[model samples]
Target chain A: MEPYPYTVNPFVHQDRFWYPFVSPFDPCPPIRAKRYVVPPNQFLGFQPPNLLQFPPAQALMKGTLWPALFSPYKKTGKVEIKDP
Target chain B: MWVYEKKLQYPVRVSQCNPTLAKYLIEQYGGADGELAAALRYLNQRYTLPDKVTGLLTDIGTEEFAHLEMIATMVYKLTKDATPEQLKEAGLGDHYADHDRALFYHNAAGNPFTATYIQAKGDPIADLYEDIAAEEKARATYQWLIDISDDPDINDGLKFLREREVVHSQRFREAVELIKEYNEQKNFF
Candidate 1:
């Protein structure tokens, strides 16, 4: 059966302002949040509690080897294997 | 032969605006090594660049226009619907804090624009390296802005712009590689 509920991770905050893994930011106080600049009428969907809580469908693995199977260079290109 | 586009990607409308952010963005608009300078630098540099570098310079220069648009949008949104009381509360009620009625001609903040940022050294290597540095700096500033903002709208726009900087940096790196190739070929003769 399909999963009942979906969840999204909060850690995945992607934006111009948020530099992942390397930003020296000290969060402003909650007062700043109250007065935060709310954009006029932009709406995004709600975040789920736990992203990837359920496993991906079994059929997803079927095409995972597409690059190896249909690669243009798989047969024509030379593969040089050298001992290190 | 550039003409004005009479629209904004995202409306610059904000109920409560912070002047501080406006000022920083203005620095980006006209500040040394900022977008305006970057655009002008690359476009002008194209004239003297080798044929190999011509296309790369033109592409990078054109992309600067998009950066300019993004900064202008941020400034506009920060200034739109802003009230004097709100500006004062944000500690931005200075002689230069004229929101609600300004055109797209000032710095990221509300300061009078300056042309000090764009430098064309005439040396291709120097200018190309400078452009690479400028891309990294702009990316850093975008990171700083994202860190302070929780607004998803701004975040969405900001993320795209940041990724663009990364792409531009790669292009500049490629340009450098091409230049090195030309120099090596010349010396080999």
Candidate 2:
């Protein structure tokens, strides 16, 4: 199967927002579009809790003052590349 | 993996000290929908995502830390020189009673920041959708803050932060699409 080319423009048929439909009975129909029903959430029987909730108290420690302290660093086995 | 930039993403020079506004603006600093939550959510989610998307999450999440700093700076500047009487007059006595002039992470209502503000679901699509929603909520909160603020310097910072939320939402939408495409490819193979 050929890979589907993705485009930034949402109007393209291949875009995620667009749904594809095929009509067998009628070759051509005015405004040929089918209503798509979204699948119910199987994981959670009821609707999920609201994403927005009240702010909670501070938990995480403040980030370190130095850049190297906040993030991880791994030494490379190879020598460093230089433009000069 | 991360570098500390001395300057803020946007300049914040609050000329006036309004403890009342500080009380409200603290929400963005440590609120449920604030930058701290956003940064944690994305950084935690990055570990489970595909490589490219992980990079996206890491970069955006790091940027959120900067935003968090910017908010903290605003809160500190606003309450710097406020006296107990001035604070009481501006309806910030309760906050001052608790934190004095120091900036502690908490919402406008004085609720402390908690881990519950964010989630790190193993699924990318679900997580991306959640992120989009989070950005929208932050944007709405910034809009509210901007509406109540009269200081040009502070308003300028809030506007920049609000616009960043919109941009983040768009990027998350694209991330959703990318993840979907990856799943489709995996199934095809």
The prediction achieving the highest lDDT against the true structure is 2
lDDT of each: 0.55, 0.69
Per-model TM-score on C-alpha atoms: 0.59, 0.67
For all predictions, the C-alpha RMSD in Å is 15.5, 18.3
Docking class of 1: incorrect
Poorest stretch of ten by lDDT in candidate 2 chain B: B180-189
Name every residue pair that clashes in candidate 2: A56-B112, A56-B113, A56-B114, A57-B112, A57-B113, A57-B114, A58-B112, A58-B113
For model 1, residues A1-84, the per-residue Cα lDDT tens digits are 222124532222111121123234646422211111111111222222343322234212221112111101111112222211
lDDT of 2 by residue, B46-81 (tens): 999877688889888998998999998998898889
Off by over 4 Å in 2: A1-84, B183-189
